[model samples]
Target: MKLPPWFRRRRVGVAATLVSVAALTAVMAPLQDDIGLLNEGLLLLLLTLVISGTWGREVGIFAAVTSNLALNFFFVEPLHTLTVQSPENVLALFVFLGVSIIGSSLLAAARASAEEARRREAETQVLLSLSRAMIGQTEPAEALASLCREVVAAFDAPGASVLTAAAGGWGVLAHAGSADAGRPADAQERTMAEQAASSGQITRIGHTGLGNSRRPRIVAPSGTQRIREADVGSAFVPLLFGDRTLGVLRLDGPIGATPFAQHPDSLLAAFAGEAALGVQRAELAQAASHADALRQADEMKTALMTSISHDLKTPLAGIKTAVSSLIDTSVEWSDEDREAFLATIDSQADRLNRVISDILDLNRIESGVIAPARRSVHVASLLDDVRERTALVTKPRVVTLDAGADIYAQADETLMAQALVNLIENAAKYSAAGAPIHLAASAAGASVEIVVSDEGPGIAARDLPHVFERFYRAQEGSRRVKGSGLGLAIVKGFVTLSGGSVRVESAPSGTRFVIQLPVAEQAKASA
Candidate 1:
């Protein structure tokens, strides 16, 4: 059996110390006549010193008293009696008693101090390890589990658990070791933990009796209770932070076990303090994360309002002005003037339709309704289709495409084509009038790469990372672009859903958007 920590090392029990003294007396009694009286006194004193050094001061004192009486009755002048008959013997006895008691006291005190220092050092190490483990832990359940593991390892207990008060009452947040070890084995343990948390004091529950008669009982503290032998079965330490009792840390040991039979209040406090901090950190992190989410939602709402007010209103105003002019008959208008007015109405109406379409696409993407029907799509044909569709948007600007007839990509052709159209339109809108917009497709390893590049003023370095984020637009020179910032975001969503990835590279001279899609089997086989 493993000895209790207090009894291990150089310490022994009272019963063992007495038995040792008796054994020494038995061996020395028969040699009383052969040994000198003073010499006998010295041998007994030597035994007192040895016992005191090993078994501690209290046991040493008891040993000294017992030995002095034994020496007088068994070997002193007055054999088998308490009376001393010689002056020299009386003086020797007094000196021996004084020396034994004083020497033992000093030696025991020194040993106790050394043990305290070692205990403090070990506790410090445990606290340091626990603090490091808990640092930067944002998840509440994960933090609690880490604390439980640390407690079990530090005490060598059968198990440890952390409990917190939730809406549904007390719940075990996390546990380590034996499943039942941390749970309340009986109602008494539950009561003990409740008492600890309510009072912010350490409480304990203990088991006593034998066989089927064994029962658990509350051993809660009137004040702060340290880990005593009777309180070792289970300990409920309140996790207190400031004025709040955040939770309880329960430590469990097997009945009759000695590994955790004795522990100091300071050591328990250190662990509880760290546990409280971990819980508080997790709570704060959760609050911060929730607050951030709400803030982002508010920002998105504001951006949407701004887009509607500027982009939608601008197109509507142009259409309304052109229609009102066409209906007025007070002036005889030329055919040229009427034609210009009709053209303005048509272009502005198209612009309004495009904006509404972009908004609907963004909604679908965000709502997770964009599921692509994957198929082998010829790259050359997809590029040609996109170029034709965006001819109006890229008017007056030269557009170029480079794709081999054998190149094909695994993607939904309609989604991929729409994604490319957005890129081409975006390039044309930002670049100088007539600046060439180039589209290319090539086989790269196991994927097909589609590139759209423009000799436009490239995106600012600070804006490149967030370009694909919905409702985000980089300022063009001193003014923001007049459109919903959903084009690039839709492009990304569609490409991602089609089993492809998109990225952009920009410099002061130009900008390049690259999309990579899985290469179709036909393309690989044909190559």
Candidate 2:
């Protein structure tokens, strides 16, 4: 709406105040006593000239004319009037008045130009600082907060803060100016800030309500004890990493505080992007390192197990042969002595053979060789065979397989038995030998899952991720139980060759190993 006449007049009065001092100084210039005040007149005139553009060219001209009239009336001899007294007075008056006006205007204009240049420079500096801080930050949090703080300080804003978007809500992270009378932090404000942030909207609140009161955010105050709650102002700059909105930059300050001298909206987005990329990189690196370590450890364990199996078998086989030769058609000592010798040989050979077999079976699986093959075998029947074989290593765990009409998995029966046997053996080795080892199989969708569960101390949390890797005995402490770490690795490789996947889940109760394979077409048809 157009201002009323009175309001227009009032504005004119306000504008007149800008140059009134210059006008008065010029008016006193003609008085001989006021001659010294001419310098004051020049100074005032200069000030007026400097700020002249703020009003307009008309204001500037009025200032110049007023100063000249005052000089002619008050200082040129006959005081309080605009009459020129004599020729010398005329020249002196005109020269003095004209020089002052011209000089003032020129100097003022120059100063004004310099001031403009300085302001532009400050803005450029703000932009540069904002740009670097934003771009350098691959992680958005610290940088965004710093950006707001630095920019506020650079532009002399009151305070700075930032709010970011998070799952289900937002997070408020801010810095304050000096204390003032205001509400202390509370959950209410936090919730509001978070909600606004999640919405990815620029929120602002001022002393006089610049924006919605529900979620007022702006250039908030910096460090201070007492903030006048009424004077609080806030603003939110949404952090956009790409097409997605990553978060928001929420800040607040005292009322009337300005934003960064030159607000660079684009810089905020850049900082968020950097943060996201850094976080992603860190996660990927961790995953890759874990996988690599497991692979190396498994390889080492496989080699060691194979060597041990071979070493043990060689001596055991020789001993067995020598004992047989003693028993069969050879000159012998007393009956008692021969019997004792034979018994000892038999016991030792049996024990050695069991150990050698376990090692060889594990090694063979790791070396990618399937065991002795035979005719069609029932899953239940094969499990029983495996249970018997596993008894030689660690006593049979509570082995169980459904009595269903011999569900068949097409593979070398012996190899399948060996794989299952190894798995059972491993469960016993890792846990107490007598632990209830549960085995279950079921047809789920198109695949069959065979899960072996042992009630032993679950693997260590740190080691759980690598339990399948050979020689990875869940820890680095006293490794009392010795084994070719190849058991699990072999099992894994065998199961994989049979076209399947294996996974281990360990919790406080016990560790569970699950193997899933695509059942043969016939098995699927039955299901």
Candidate 3:
């Protein structure tokens, strides 16, 4: 609880000094003769210094005058009288009074200086805390709310709030304490806040016993620059960055409580500056994030257009040419020639279908719409299915499967087959015409490893890590590897959807793609 201002005034100090002096004289009067007049004056001077240190300068001065009179009466040659008989005693009395007054003033000034240092230290700590909060929180609303709480706690105010200028008018960005505490209690208080924001100055209002005054009363103290003081209550600090005024910080203290008044005006303004900087930084970060998203979207569109113009059109051109050859009337085509043309049409159509499927599958995977239905899948059967589906493409290249009969995995059979087909086809496209593709499956502790390896020229080390990225090509331009580049990305997505992981190892001799799936029995045991 805060004491009334009168309780803290000089009257209380004067009464305390009187009581203290009376007590000292009662104890020291008997020893005055043995201690001598000089000793008595020293003891009285000590008493005056103690009173001054405890009750401040005004009370100390009063104590000094009272002590001088008491020493002349109770301990000087003319005991119990205000008159000092000897010239030496008169000199001693004057010296004692002068020293006590001077000592009290020095002691009081020292105490005030120490108090001001402590207050400044506290203000620095609050500013440091605000800086940390601003840097730590990325969201503007959350950071401002945290700062409001800190302000309310630091000042012991009823509440605090931050208001930002909005389209139509001011909007409360964040507030702490009671719902009504930080908010303007009336139009007059709101106008004061707006005045501070518009003028780029600190505005304070103190409540009189009758009510708040109609106009704000301003005062400047000796030690501070442009420090404004009122009776005691609310303060409105503007948040200014450069020439722009971002918002206002409203501090609401109770009437007769000098929470905001206890700190210097410069410290409050520093807090406002910190809040403005946080607002500007948050806005910049948000703008950067938005720009990044737009750039990614543009890149995706460009890559998709590139793929359509090359991979899709290549097969389409072959199909159209083969159809035109089969229907040509001028030439007498042989039975074998007709059959070859039909085969070309079929192969090109299959290739076109694969490219479209990869595009759609990639879209689904990226959209998080694909959910795998995992179950026990026989390793040998899965490989056999993949081999049959990819036979048309992997024609001249040989595919050899190596797997144990007992090996089984927990996976979605359809997704697993599709992923394997992509890998096998990818290997066939890159390897030598007659090169052998190896498919191997083995039990490795609680998991099963399925590896599709090719004896083709290994991928460049720079391209190895990005092999699973959609639309990435190791070689750019006309000489680049064929296909949409979505095959390996689909392989990784499908495997991961089935609760499995895929990785690759490449060297000068060859490239190997490994997929690890949980063993059927092990998955069941854990579940």
- For each candidate, what is the lDDT? 0.79, 0.57, 0.79
RMSD of 3: 10.5
Off by over 4 Å in 3: 1-12, 21-54, 57-279, 317-348, 476-480, 521-527
Q: How close is each model in CA RMSD to the real structure?
A: 7.5, 16.0, 10.5
Q: Could you tell me the lDDT of residue 511 within candidate 1?
A: 96
Residue pairs clashing, model 1: none
Q: Per-residue lDDT for 346 in model 2?
A: 75
lDDT of 1 by residue, 188-262 (tens): 555677788887777666532111211223554456564345534676788999999888887775433222234
Strongest candidate by TM-score = 1
List the candidate 1 regions with Cα displacement exceeding 4 Å: 1-20, 23-53, 57-65, 68-236, 247-261, 319-346, 478-481, 507-509, 521-527
TM-score of each: 0.69, 0.38, 0.60
